[model samples]
Target: MKSSTFKYSMLTVGIAASLGIVSTANAAESAAASTPTIDNVATATYKIGAIAQTPVQSNKVTVNITQSAAFSLTAKNDDGNATDDYNRSAIVTPKGRVAFNHTLTNSGNVEDTYTLSLAQGGTIPGSTQDASSYDLAATNVTYTVYNADGTVKKATTVTGTDFQNTNIVLKPNEHADILISAKTVGNVGGNSQNLTLSAASTFFTNSDTTKATLTNINNSITKVPVFKITSKVSSTLNLNDPSSKVTYTITVRNDETASYAANANNIIVFNGLPEGLRLADQPNLSVSNNATIVPGNEGKGSSSADDSVRVTLLNLEPGQEATITFDVQKDQNETLTNPKNVINHASVSLDLGENQVIYDSTDGTDPKQNTNVFYPAGDDSEVTDGTTNTTTGSDSAAPLVANQRALSIVSPTKKEIPTSTTESTQVTHSVILSNTGKEVEGDKPGEVKFTITPNANNKVTVVTGSVELIYDADNNPNTPNAVYTITRDVNGDNDLSTAVPKNGAPPWTGMAPNSIVTITYKVESNKAVIDTTETTTVSLVLGGQDVPTLGERIAKNTTTVKGLKLVKEQALNENCAASTTLTFTQADVAASPGNCIVYKITAFNDFSNADARFTFNDLVINDTTARFNNKAQVLTTSTSPAFTIRLAEVADANVLPTDNTYGATASSTAVSGTVTNLAPQKYAAMVFAVKINPDGTTTP
Candidate 1:
């Protein structure tokens, strides 16, 4: 065998762009991880006498790559564009929704997965306001992952049910687009909230400082809103339904919120125009990118009911939005004469076309749900003439809620107080009312009435005239010397009701919208008895005689009297140090050998409870479980049985010096006493004591 030496070139090993970067084609093909074997051998060619023989080869050599994990995330809007708010901000009203977009790439050498999470509230890195406060347990949110071209898809959504098992797998510098759709919780017309979305590398956590969602919602009026169609008063407020004209626009969006999309055949819009209002202009249908609307189902006024307008929409793809526009005028035949608010809202129904798949209805936002302060009879206040409610139904937008009147309760319904049986005892209760409409409630004679019904045991009356007013007026923080006066209701039927605000007091017809009115009343204990309750029923109605019923409520104030009490206290005799005097002090003291432990039991009745009336009769006291039997002084000086028990009583609590009721069955083990007739504001007492044996052992 002959060998020939040939000059060879030196070789170097390295990746194109450091690791799993785009510059390398085999970046994603590196499947061999921290496990086993890639072998390489060197081959040489040799020639002898100008003739090349077989090539020579060397032994095998192996190389390895250590696993590395790292990632990067960027935020964008729905259009995949960054915004002025760090590319992560949006503004919305109640019942509305907003989406936060993000792109994540596994900028590492290996295929990896990361855990995804969404949090309700937390301040972002660049927010001026504190973290938004969440309400209503409404934590419904969703996220969709898609390839760069929006073609490759693994799952439809990552919901709360399966979010734990959901993951995004990427190799090397591969990336995926994440769309997080945050739904508004609920009827929060005047409130806002914030959220944070986060992700953590599942297997390898060496790079953890690369995660946190921080989008501020400081400018979003609709911080939270309901889903579907939203309606707004496009025209003016307080127009005569019979003669006045107004316009409204209904916005409908097709958001594929369900786990999967169901192919449907029908999408019809039905609007029951409010009373006293008639359809004037035929609805104009408009569709957004890729949406199709069919204008054939227009049923304006031809139907039996006043629901004048009915329009049909067709083929609304997910993420597409459609709108319905129309006009309405007051009906000449309407009977409502005085100024009253009228609401015009609509609904939409969908048919899945499948057998027995019941139709789904989406009701528009009602004024009751808006809950924002509303002006009546066309308010010209500075509140921008016409207001909008951000909530809408998925199928139909809830037009604005408008009615002549309605009120809400802001305080808890139940109230209680401790009772007293003293005849002529006085108790006071304060009931506050808030006017929800834009009128000054209770300014008229019968606008607001309270039916105060009392039993024979008590008398209820309103607190009126110059009462001692304790208020914080001196800028001294709640200290009061100023006399604030309130009004009185003097009706002959034993019913105290509010009149016009004649004096500078309450019930003064000055209650503004969303303002509170407080009415204070007193309950006189006429013949109240012990263990008895005083329940006074109070009924309220907030509507004028000119207008119909607006709102009504009933409340109850009750209290029950308590009975007798018992107390037992003990003091040490300190080895009988004061035996000659036998004076005892109810205080802390240590006992030595042969020290006597004095025990006093007293039965008492509260003065404010029964004052001068009720009495506790034939009361008996029993003593058991007294564990001092062995330690008590039974034998005097450790010699003979001198088990003598002594008793003493207060003179006033006894009928005579030897009264049976005042005497107790006193013993070294236990003691008890009784009271024949324990009158109100009076007490009875019995005293007894025990002594410890000097030798630290119980004397037999």
Candidate 2:
């Protein structure tokens, strides 16, 4: 089949010349061609003609076309680094903030839109499995998007989900920076939080919808423990009392959730005693949670100025506390030039280890953990400082005195009761005698004795068999030390017939400074309404001389009048006899709003007395809603007994009395007249009427 064959070929390239669309080779040569170009069209026509012995044919074609779409995106840190771009980890304190910087670039040949957001779930790097996860709440994070030239584009405080919903467009080779700032929640410590960031392009596609341009880039923050030291004293020092002890308590606290440890050694606590104070005993040390204490130097001598106590602790975990308590006493030989100006002071120091990690917000530099802290720093005006890391707490005591004796007495029963007509009335009184003075010298207890004198009109039939006595320990009357003796005045005379030796002698010893003795006795009153006051005075004789300041300590016993005792009660119902007694509480009258009240008054005389008269006046009805019936009735025994009852008179209808209704005034006239010559053991009754207004207009 060797036959002559005609062959023709034609080549054409569709070119959008005005749009800068060129051949693949030219496009690769010019970097500007990567940028998108606007709409433009160009046409190229080709024709070929061939002539031979037979027939020859050729074909040419031209076509118009549009550029294909393309998209690309890249995300990096603000430094333009491609890997390990953002802050990987940071040590922060609770309620502290950290900032992360990132950049989003459109590296494709065409313009593109990108969405940036933070990933919510991920494990924090270099953190335990139980560490807390990052919080993506809008309230905790703030973000700002900036243009390539550093101009702010948008600033907002929106959550990751909200930011992802926004579309950010960029041209080819254009980039934008984003600053994501976040703050740790309060009280979140001992754990790390991971913040993952993501950037996705609208035109980009991935098999997993959760991932796009950038994903799972973790930025983490951790909260470290904080340490603080404090101290306190028990009480004020007493210079005159050598046996007095003052306790000092020093405390160390790890106020965070992060556990802290030292290298090769535990935390050391040191305290130095102030001048004029000596350590009394070993310190009692206690640790909370998982920790152990090692005792160091205990205060051994009182003469050295450097006398101090030390304790070491291991494995002080988060939220743990430790305390040290020790007692100090005033040195008797170390006399102060100004006794009143003496100060007993102590100090404590805490050694944070060399490797302790402290997270502070003020400075970015990580300082060495090896630091010493003194409680009551130099600024504390109450404490004097020997050094920067040493604090001194002080307390002052009053000046000493020689042989100071002060005495006082108190009677629990000082009121008087009247004598009875048929028989004699007996009354008992309790008197407390105390030595309110400084310590006495020479070991001689203060001398204290009692003298009783009865009223001549009502002499004592018998001064009781004997009086009771008790010693008061620690000023508590209920807590008695031992029983003693009480001198009795057998007859109604000024002299005390019952005698006991004084000055730490038999039956009256142990009455030292700040000591108390209680005495109790009984007396009888013979005549009614007479001088029945059985006055008893306690005298204190110290160092063979009377304690002049022992003021007249007197207690009297008298009787109350035996005539009538008046009692009044209110009732909601008109039938005063059937109504229950008013309890005088809100709940008792809450249910009964409309008051149709009746007041029942009773005069009771239990004791027999001659020529007795009972009168009732100024019976105040304080309820503003009450309108009295202006009438009253009296019922009494003894047919011939004289009694009268009348309405309570008011002087003014507009001026209100102190305790009466607004429209009522104080009255001087008697509401019920006197009952004269009433028999013994007899009672009288009276009733008054009142009504409550329904309109509430009378309410005060």
Candidate 3:
């Protein structure tokens, strides 16, 4: 059987080789095969037999990628907007139009539509720290967008609510130029506004916003046409005199820049005359550059009042000045009692159809007024002589005789007399009596007398011997030598008992105009008068009669007499005695580098009428050998006055010391302060220690 199987396998192999197929007969023969065995199988597999087997295959998937919608926008100044970067802020007049040119650029990847808006009074983004932001209303503005070639793309006016609704489409990396026109609705200055431009993509709803500020330049640059009016009087003005004629050369100069020439119009110059002056005749008006002049109103019964003059002038170009000459007459009137009434001021105004711009010399914001006061020249007194009157005979003429006299009293030596000592001290005051009125010739030379009265609270003792009388050499050179007498009421009974007279006269007699009399006297005061300000009233008598117009003159002064003492001491040992005469030599300082020295400052307000504050200085250690140990200068004790005492070290040689070494070459330390509110009869003291240096060459 094996031989028969081998022959069959061989025969099958031969047949497979001829048919290109291989058989497993030999492997089956080698294995033990008792019978056809079939085991239980959980699953079954089926393989398709085919002429050819196809390889595993797959279908490839493709996709296209793109960028998400993203964009940004920015605003910049256009080329024609401003030549200089500093010109970003402009000055515009009221009711005037101003334009701001800007470029809106799309700085992002995608095309975007940018919306325009404005913001005011908020934190400005992309601005310098602490920088002032622009502020304005968007309702009064109009704008126009331009294409790259400068052609207008859109023009519209926006309201407050719809200002931010305007939009412009921009391609990626493209920009649009724009001009924003604004009109000033009212008078505003120092105002600022911001223009905000934002861009957003259609795919992306989110938008980015940018800001640019618009500043209104300072008023000095943007002010209306500046017109300066100056006037010059032809002759001096005399108070209460109608004969004098004043020709006023009024110069009106246009000082604004040429850019403001467009706003110039037929300027109406109006000047209102003050009281006591009237228009004399027609004004001589002329303009520079041949500007036409049309008479508006002149003289009485015209559109303008008799006291005011008005004229119409052609447009005045920048740097052009006009001159208007008008004459004014002063009529007879009562003399002014106040000195301020002796001069007057005039105001000028310019009417520019819609706006009345005023240039005030006094207040810049108001109108153009007189920058200087016009004063009355020459002798303006109406008085002639006592008991006599003179008049011009005209109804408007004032009486020649004055109703009152003018006298003035002034102190020359000291305006304030300070009482600094307890002992009875003399305070000398020198005074001058002058007549500041018009000249008067009397039947007999006028007699001018002065009586001085002292305060009742003061112990008045006048130094009769010091009384003197002299003439004012500058004003009254020809006047006779002054004769005066000073009488004091020794008992304060207001009587002329004790009299002292100059060498020539009993009283100031035969005095002339603009004459002056000098008197010097001394008074003695005691502790009873401490802290009491005394006023000495002086009465004047002219021609043996009390001068009603020459009112009484009073002089006031104060006195303070308090005692403060500073004592110094030095000792080789710890124990020391303070003395005012304590002295240290250079040899002593060289011997002991750390010697102990003491200073005792005592303040006593023994007779002070009021609370006192005292200051002491130059409490120093003088050592030429070496510098004193500043840190060792310690406060030893503060007692007495029963008040707080603050002590501090000061620099060297600064205080004005009582000792002769204050301005000397010696090295010294100083200190100063106030012992505030020291009561009468109270005392305070402070003691400090100082260490001398062996070598006085260092400071600490």
Candidate 4:
């Protein structure tokens, strides 16, 4: 042991020196004496069967992808079969065939056994070689299968030896086979389905000699063909008119496991008259197993690798499922040359030019039905004979006696009215049509209408009857002007042209021959006119038959004249000496032009037994400066009461003392005019201050 450790260190140092690992010999000597010690030796045991030292590696992660579509299945004892394998989810279709697909690949370095199978419902266990070291069981992982509607059809756990495929191995760079199939349920046109597949495990294992174990290995479930539809409706084709024939080219494909049948006989059936017509007989049906039908006849018309053809189908498919076309000529029954009644298949006729004829398909039972009466009138004309030859001279007196009738307005004798008042007033007028010429039973009530226009002063409205009139009133009440129109409201038709014919034509036949109507209008006065002359018009119309005589009635208009009256008059009170006379007056005026006179007259006098009296005098007469001559010689007297006292004119001598207020008291008189009294009485008085003058002259 003379220094075994040192000797080993020296050897190491020598090697390091040779390799140029140390600076000098002295450093090497120091390192040689030192004892070599190792830490963590107990934990440094090397893994057996490992070949080479691993280099420092960067962390990396790789993803594995698998795509698939199919149904679900259960585990079975088959050669290298995966337990609880779900090829796909679940699919439900409405019609026809359905298809499924899938893909699988090795996602790891070691070989693995990937099993795919489907079951209605249940769970299967997985297996691993080393039971102590590796676990392939998902530890009660539940596998679920869902229906097309997402309903869970079945659920099971993977427990036993192998949940995936047992004893099956998959090598690196290798992928498994995925199978998809198209299955049919029933029927032809419509189909729908859904399928889903999901993985429920996180562990993987190898059944090799090494019995390796892998963690974090993920299994996935995929949904395949989530939804599918099988049936489709085809376009419609007309079979009557050759032009109606529709060339339908449809690309039909099926993924069903069985061979699909698409023929004229196998297609859906739709039987009925097309739009308003039908075929004369059952059309012939000729076809090629893989060829398209033509327009004229049903036969192998065209062929192509595309499997697309133009078929002229005599019969249409129900809901237009299969596309078929034909020349669709109008059935023999549609041809005009075909008689209304003819023998069955009697040379079905079609009208060709140059008088050429085609036969009709009329049964023998209807012999008369094949007549020309039912045929279209093509440039055919007919004539009727009437008596137009007659003598114009009246050879004998009263040779022919005929009866005629006429109408007249009997009820409303007047039509016009005067609108003078400020308030809107309603004027009613009615017309009675009487058969003045002759009376007949069940006389149809002739329609009567009245039309009115609204004016700034008034608005016209129909109060009792309709306002629709049809006539040619050329300012003529009987007719309407060409620019304006009137008409009867037959069916309430307000179209004037329909009621009263346009282009100078007679009215429609709906209206009665003769009618009479009296129209009345109520007009409102303007807001600013308190009293004014107002004229209103009401048009009366009498048909030619109603008023056979000309100028029977003149268009009369009534004018209303009104005057505004002073409703009330008042006077201000004023004091006057008992010996003086006073008068009150105002200028009377008229608002309208008329031969009227305005007089200055005194109103009421409140003082009778006072010191004052009321009188009116003229200062100038006919441009002559005359003395103030009293006209009203009223005297104040103590015997009279304090009420209104009337003034007397100069012509009345009984109550006169021309200039004197006979007994008015000075302290109690109110006056408005100049006056004089013989004696003074201290009484209260009130007088009207009014003056009357001739020739436009007055005293101040």
Q: Assess candidate 3 and give its TM-score to the true structure.
A: 0.32
Highest lDDT: which candidate? 1
Query: For residues 16-80, could you state the per-residue lDDT of candidate 4 as single tens digits?
Result: 56865432211011122221111000000011012111111111111101111111112111223
Model 1 segments more than 4 A misplaced = 1-401, 407-425, 455-510, 526-532, 542-552, 565-700
Q: Candidate 4: lDDT of 435?
A: 31
Residue-wise C-alpha lDDT for candidate 2, range 1-700, written one tens digit per residue: 0001111111122234454543221111112234221111111111111100111111111111112222222223332322332345554444455566555655445555666666644553344432345445632334455554666767666654466555677775566655556554432444456666655655443222322454434444444334445444444567668777656555554443224221212555555554465655444544443445444333333464334566655345554456666666665544444543333332222332222333211111214222222111221122211111222222111122222555556554553433332222345566676666664311332244455444454444325554655566467656636565544444322211233533343443345667776666665444443233444443323343534332224433333333233444443442333234443211112112233444334444434443232222222222111122122211222111211222222232221112212122212322333323223445444443333333322332
Q: What is the per-residue lDDT of model 1 for residues 474-586, given as tens digits with 9 covering 90 to 100? A: 23444432223444345522112333333353333344565554444565432234346566555665456434222325455564443444444455555454333443333
Measured with C-alpha atoms, the lDDT of residue 597 in candidate 1 is: 55
Q: After superposition, how far is residue 478 of candidate 3 from its true place, in Å?
A: 45
User: Where in model 3 is the C-alpha error above 4 Å?
Assistant: 1-87, 94-97, 105-110, 121-138, 145-153, 171-177, 183-229, 237-244, 252-267, 274-282, 289-307, 311-322, 330-700
Give each model's whole-structure lDDT: 0.41, 0.39, 0.37, 0.24
Candidate number achieving the greatest TM-score relative to the actual structure: 3
Q: Which 10 successive residues of model 1 have the least lDDT summed?
A: 1-10
Q: Which sequence of candidate numbers ranks them by lDDT, best first?
A: 1, 2, 3, 4
For each candidate, give its TM-score against the true structure.
Answer: 0.27, 0.26, 0.32, 0.18
Off by over 4 Å in 2: 1-86, 95-97, 123-131, 138-143, 159-161, 183-187, 206-211, 228-700
lDDT, model 3, position 236: 46
Q: Rank order by TM-score, top first? A: 3, 1, 2, 4
